[model samples]
Target: MSWTERQRALLGAMGLRVWGETAPEHALATSDAGLEDAAAPASPSDPDPAPPRPAAPERRRAPAPQADAASPPPRASPAIDLGAVAAMEWPALREAVAACRACDLCQTRTQTVFGVGHARAHWMVVGEAPGEQEDRQGEPFVGAAGQLLDRMLAALQLSRADDGDAASRVYIANTLKCRPPRNRNPSAEELHACEPFLVRQIELLRPRIILAMGRFAVQALLRSDEPVGKLRGRVHRYQGVPLVVTYHPAYLLRNLPDKARAWEDLCLAAGVAEAAAEAAG
Candidate 1:
């Protein structure tokens, strides 16, 4: 593609080449006779004659490596009491998660993202892990991806609010409480350490239908490594609760065409939730 003069100048400033454009050639050739005449004139006029020598090329050393704001997790982590984690109530669990040092993730996270939404909602959403925004705010699902999820849940007449009706409310949590540094995938040890908190939350809420978003959430719940496409069409079970798998909102943002499939997953989950509510009523 061709660029305008201003555009090319800007690209040059940024050290990026404009694609498909030929580089302009520079000519720096000087004749030996011209240099000899010029030097002869200078030498005749000088009292102390000395030959001119070229200056040595400047030496540039590479800059030192600066550290990133979020450092990698330490290799070792402190142990957590599974029994204590399982027995804690919502308030206690939130405090415990906030103070947890159970895994290496705890070392790098800005804060722990425990969960958000109603205490006993019929619909629950479980995602993979805390990301940059979630870690900063200490709330699961709190950015662009969260916005899309809100739109999806809104279409289903459900929300992530503490005051909505039980059937219209949705509780959201992550497989891992603390975010991995640089938003990298959560390690198995990190997931294992955080599992009890999620288990206790699910046990307490006992949602009619659980929406498992992203690969790790699916694998953590269903113990299956299958891709979401292969697992989403039908209902599955998790802790005796109906579970539906679907691509994560973040993934859907990148792959817009798969939104229809996500809608289908939502509908399937909705039907399962409706069925469960009716059975209870």
Candidate 2:
């Protein structure tokens, strides 16, 4: 239990002491050897450091090309043959009308209300079809609606005067020449069958403006599903002539509030008519 022996016991517990009765230098040398053994290099079987990761592949983007400014313009379709129709005499046209049966409406019609107005009219008003009153009268507008229309025309300073120029100044027609049962709307088949006559009448009269009154009339002319509320107040073109859509007199009769809007539309139509007449003059 001496100081040296106590030092040796402490070093032995730490596994750095040599079990031998030796000198201080020998013991120090043995302790150095023990420390070297504890610090020996690890085995070759241990895992190696992971290899350096390869860089991500570069993404090749396709370049955007510029549009060609020198491309040729698109070609348009041939214009409709309106001249051939314009050359047809009124008597010949009337004869053609007399023998027409293009639609089922022809079967029920009392007479072909072909149209009434100036043959060379600048303003043409087209309605949906003849009603009970019109069928009985052989005219397009002769009922309460017709009376309203007459008043409307008079307001615009025009009339049914078959005088030389007047006869050629105001024309009227319908989408269908015949009256549907019970004043109902004309069917698509009826409208399709009768549309050619209207087209022909427009071509012959060469009206500067067409007033399409009512939803049916607007739809037939524009071939669109848009409601009359949306269709009215704006000017549209049909077969080179301007078309102004307005509420039918019959509809205005039932809906008094809409009369104000209808009046504005009538004014628009009148303005168009006046402009056309002035241009023609």
| Residue lDDT tens for model 2, 1-281 | 12355445543443332222322332222122222111123336625322232232233322232366686422211121223333567776665455555455656768777788777777888898888888888888887888777766654555655456652356888888778878778887677655656777887778877889987887677775556787676566777677778888888778867766665666566555555566678
Error of 2 at 260 (Å): 1.4
Pairs that clash in candidate 1: none
RMSD of each: 26.9, 44.5
- The 0-to-1 C-alpha lDDT of every candidate, in the order given, reads 0.75, 0.63
Task: Kindly give the stretch of ten consecutive residues in candidate 1 with the minimal lDDT sum.
Answer: 25-34
Compared with the true structure, what per-residue lDDT tens digits does model 1 show for residues 1-281? 23467655544543443433432111111122211221232445655443342232233332333467586633433456666666789999999888777677777889889899999899999999999999999899989999989977765567999985888999999999989998898876777667778989999999998999999997678766667887676676776777888999999889877876786677667767766777788
Residue 131 of model 2: what lDDT?
89
Which regions of candidate 2 are displaced past 4 Å? Answer: 1-87, 164-168
Q: Report lDDT (Cα) of residue 59, candidate 2.
A: 30
Model 1, residue 2: distance off in Å is 53
